[model samples]
Target: MSLVRKFATVASGTLMSRILGFAREMLMAAALGTGPVAGAFYAAFQFPNTFRRLFAEGAFNSAFVPLFAKEIEANGIDGARRFSEEVFGVLFSVLTVLTILMELAMPLLVRTIIAPGFASDPQKYELTVALATIMFPYLMCMSLAAMMAGMLNSLRRYFAAAIAPVFLNVILIAVLGHAWYTGADSLEVGYAMAWGVMAAGVVQLAIVWIAARRAGISIGFRRPRMTPNVKRLLWLALPAAITGGITQINTLIGTAIASGQDKAVPALAQADRFYQLPLGVVGIAVAIVLLPELARALKAGNDGEAASLQNRSVEFVLFLTLPATAALLVISEPIVRVLYERGAFTSDDTVLVSSILAVFGLGLPAFVLIKAFTPGYFAREDTKTPMVFAAISVAINITIALTLFPRMGAPGIAVASVVAGWANALMLLVVLIRRGHWGHDAPLMRRIPRLVLSSALMGAALYGGAVWLSPWLAPPASLLAQTGSLALLCAAGALVYFVLAFATGGADAGMVRRNVRRGSAAPAGTEE
Candidate 1:
């Protein structure tokens, strides 16, 4: 498949999951609002979710995919399968132990790492512990699932891994819908959502497991042993996991800091879910597809093709992310109102969430740029460089968040995260260039400024459009009217950006087509 085609497959699947995720959040807002229960639930959920990003998606994808692809190239299917089974055995054993330990230590974790602020309230603190214990095993399921996902990505089977997350949203939405219909209390809903998260992890893991089986890469049980390949994987994955999970780590810190303020946790989470739409669809989709393809190109000694792939992937990310950042900044209030300002979620909550959302918008491009740039290092087995950069970013995030959160509340934390993200992205890009792993492609250089200007213009248009449609997007408007107005604004923004992008030669259909064709061709000096 072409590179863009692969990206579309993953992005479309992610977009589906994200849309359902929004629905789930909307239901949650109505049921719980930014209440104490909501705070507990989001805090508990964030722990396992952060580990899933750190260990499963981040570590496994960064460390496992490149090695898995190399295994296929060097040892063929049998060797790859053996290696996979070996890693799975170790991963499963380690996760089982880790889950038990975490569950046992849930209370301590809650007080220390998850939410120190909650400790002052006995009800909230115990609730967070119980919820976290129930959900912590989800980390085990998702980590195992990520190993299989890495296998699938290496095999060029992107759909299953990408679409599997939809089940999480599906199950949670069902739980929330039931809670809403039955008029369950917020505490009841929190417990139900926690269990729903655990169940969803199992289902998501099964989906990818089955997909991997169908792809002819069934990995079965083996005794946990540290053979040469397994040891090598561990060595590589240790740093890569940290590097990959930097964003989550930063957010985790922010969450801990924000926990001091009532309703601040859910507010930040709500805002995060909004901006994550573009980040997941564009940044994550590009990263997932780019890594294995770039690794394969480099492994084949196709430097030109690898460089071309990096440039194009970055171009593609900017074309999507720049406009998204603009729209989120320009119309955050209306978007939050349309999505979550009903039921228990108040207009005051909307104002708070939207303000944080706008701050997060300023960092959208940086967040996505981190995704686009990290592969340049990971694809070359240089995980430590990114790891070092990630540590620096985390330190900066901590310092800034601690400094600001006391006075500024949740928006302060958001600012720290944004600044940290930009620091990380710029560091990665600079290192890539200084090390000569990346070249300055003329076309990419030319298009970036144009794309930025196009997004600025689009942002202005969206601001005017929002003002003109204020009545339709405000609280007095019906749900249909609000959603319709918001949708129209988004569509208009997209139209304006694309037209300007193409007219100004920032992007074009021909460029996309060429990338598609280029991706389909075999690397130079390599047989089909």
Candidate 2:
């Protein structure tokens, strides 16, 4: 399928999920606010999510997809099926043991690895541990879900897997809303959210399983055995894990530093929810859809096609991300206020979250580019190169966090993350150029200035629109007015970006129009 249509399929699903997720967080803010309860829940949520990123999103997908794609290309349907079953068996066993151990060691793990924010207050620390214990097993369900997702992607069934996350947000929102309506305590609502997380994982797994069955790739597990394929997956997964670890270390560092400052960790987490919307919609969708295609192209020795896909992915990411970064920065305050300034969420909390959001906005494009760029290396089974670059970025993040946190508070850590992201992106780009995997294309070169100019115009329009609309949406606002203002501002920004992009030849209106018309008719793989 065409890249644009493939991206749209995944992106539309992801956008739905993100919208529901935003509603979930809004309910959470109204229900728990940005206090100790919110802090505790954020801490608990981060524990599973950290591993989710490490195992499900980054490490597992990186190691599994390329290998699975290669196997399917070479060994046909049955051979690939056996490889998936073996991998799943090992993954299930390891994750089961790990989950059990983690639950048992919840207190110490929370105090040490995840929630340093609780250290000063015994009650909060204990609460975080308790919630974490409740949620810890989510890792097992999600790890399995990741395997299912990988299998589905290999079969080119992207819709169900992409749409699964929306169920999570829906379930969480329902649980939280039910709890609040029944006048449940904040702690009770928090527990409901935790339970909802586990439930969502189950649902996600089931959805993908159904998709696999329909694709004629239903998997069954046998006794865990150390087969050569399992060992090979392990070998690939280990370095990928370390690489994933380096990326995650920055989160751990941010959590550690943010813990010392009251409410900073949760504030940062809330801000991150906004940043992740675009990243998830564009960055992750592209990565998931592009990686398997790139792997197949490389395995088939279609170097020119692979290069074209890589270049297009980069262009696609830059075209969307640059303006997103600007809009997030421009509307950070009103966005936070409109969504979260209620109940226990004070004006001060809004200010804090907005500041962090702006700081995060600067790095938004960089982070997305990292996702777009890293797949190039992984598709070739060259995990080590990205690992080295990720290590350098981690070190840079650590140093910057240390130096900046004292001076800028939580926002400092956010800035440091952006810097680290750029560092990683640049390093990856440099290595790709050196290795002859990517280079300047005439199309990209010609499009660069136009893209930047369009984005700048969008930025100015968005910032001005937000400023003009803010006073009307300020405190003492009705929910309708606030919501309406935000909707209008976003519409205006989008219109400006698209119009300027089309008029200036920054983006192809006809291509986008054709993509929309073609819909699901686009090919499932990269166009040669």
Candidate 3:
């Protein structure tokens, strides 16, 4: 399959998960609002979720996929299986120990890192600690699942890993539904949601595990040993983990800082969900597919093919994300109000979350560009460079967020993240070019400015449409009216962007067809 098709396979699955995720968040907002329970639950969830990204997505896969792909090429399936089992055994043992340690330290963690501000409220602090302990084991399940996912991706099977996240949303939504039906109190709902997260982790793990089995790789646990391969993996993974989870690190910093303000944690969480939809769909798909594809190309000594994959991945991400950034910036309030302003969620909450979403929108391109550029390093086993840059970005995020939190509140925290993201992304891109690892090819260079122009024009149209449709999007508007109006505005924005994109050759039918077609080579005329 071509890179685009592979991305599409993952993206389609991600889109499903994101849609269901929206439903889950909507129910969560109605159930908890931006109250103490909501803040506690989101804060508690952030710990395990951050670790999941760090261990599973950031560390394991960033380091594992390239190694796994190379293992298959050199040592074949049997070698790959043995290597996987070794890594799995070590991962399982490490996670078990870590979970126990974290559980014991939950109270301290909550008081210090997770949500220091919760310390003043004993009830909220206790709830956060308990919720985090309940969800902490989720890290083990997801890390193991990520290993399986890396194996699947290396084998060029994208659907199962990409689709596995749907179960998380599905399970959570079910828990919220039951809570709503029972008219549960906020505390009761919080406990139920944490358990639901635990259940979802198990379900998600089972999904990827079963998929790995079907792919003919049944990895049984082995005694944890310091084998050469395992040691090498650990070495590469340590830095890559930091690099992979930089966004999570920044968000965690923001979360801890935002925790100082009442309602700020949940408000940031809600805004995060909105931006994460696009990030997960485009950035994640590119990140997942690009690493393995680039590794394979470079392994075969096809430098041209590697460069093409990287360039096209960047192009594809920008093509989709720039428009999304525009929409989020132009109609953030209408979008937030339509989706979230209901039941316990008030209009004031809408205003706060919308502002945060707009700031996150400004960083959308940078977020996805990091995904596009990092494979250039990871594919060559140079995880440390990205790791160094990620650390710098984290420092930037922490300084700016702390400096601004007291004055600008949650939006300031959001701005800090955007700035950090752009810094991380540009650093990676510049290093790649300086090292002669990546180059801005002719097509990519030509298309980006045009894509930016198309998105700007689309944003202007969207702004006008939002103004014209204000009545249908306002308070007291029926849900159907608000949804319809938002949908119409989005459709109009997309039409304007795509028409202009094609007209000015920012994107073209030939490029789309080339991406969708089979094989990796760029056919003549694939680029204008």
TM-score of each: 0.98, 0.95, 0.98
Rank by lDDT, descending? 1, 3, 2
State the TM-score for model 1: 0.98
Candidate 2 lDDT by residue in tens digits, 1-528: 567777877898899999998898888888888888888888888888888777777767788998888788788778888998898888889898898888998888888878765788998998888888888788888778888788777667788878988999999999988998899998888778888888998888888888777776878987899998888887777666656554456776788778878888889888989988998899888888888878888887888878877878877888888888888777888999999999878899999999999888888888888888888988888888888888888889989998999898999999888899899988988889998999668867777688888888888998888878877667777888999999999888888988888788877865355333432232344221
| Total backbone clashes of candidate 1, pairs 3 or more residues apart or in separate chains | 0
**Please, what are the lDDT tens digits per residue for candidate 3 over residues 221-288?**
89999899999999999999999999999999899999889999999999999999999999999999
Task: Give per-residue lDDT, candidate 1, residue 97.
Answer: 93
lDDT of each: 0.92, 0.82, 0.92
Give the Cα-based TM-score of candidate 2 against the true structure. Answer: 0.95
| Candidate 2 Cα errors over 4 Å, as ranges | 242-248, 509-528
Off by over 4 Å in 3: 520-528
Predictions ranked by TM-score, top down?
1, 3, 2
Deviation in angstroms for 234 in model 3?
A: 0.3
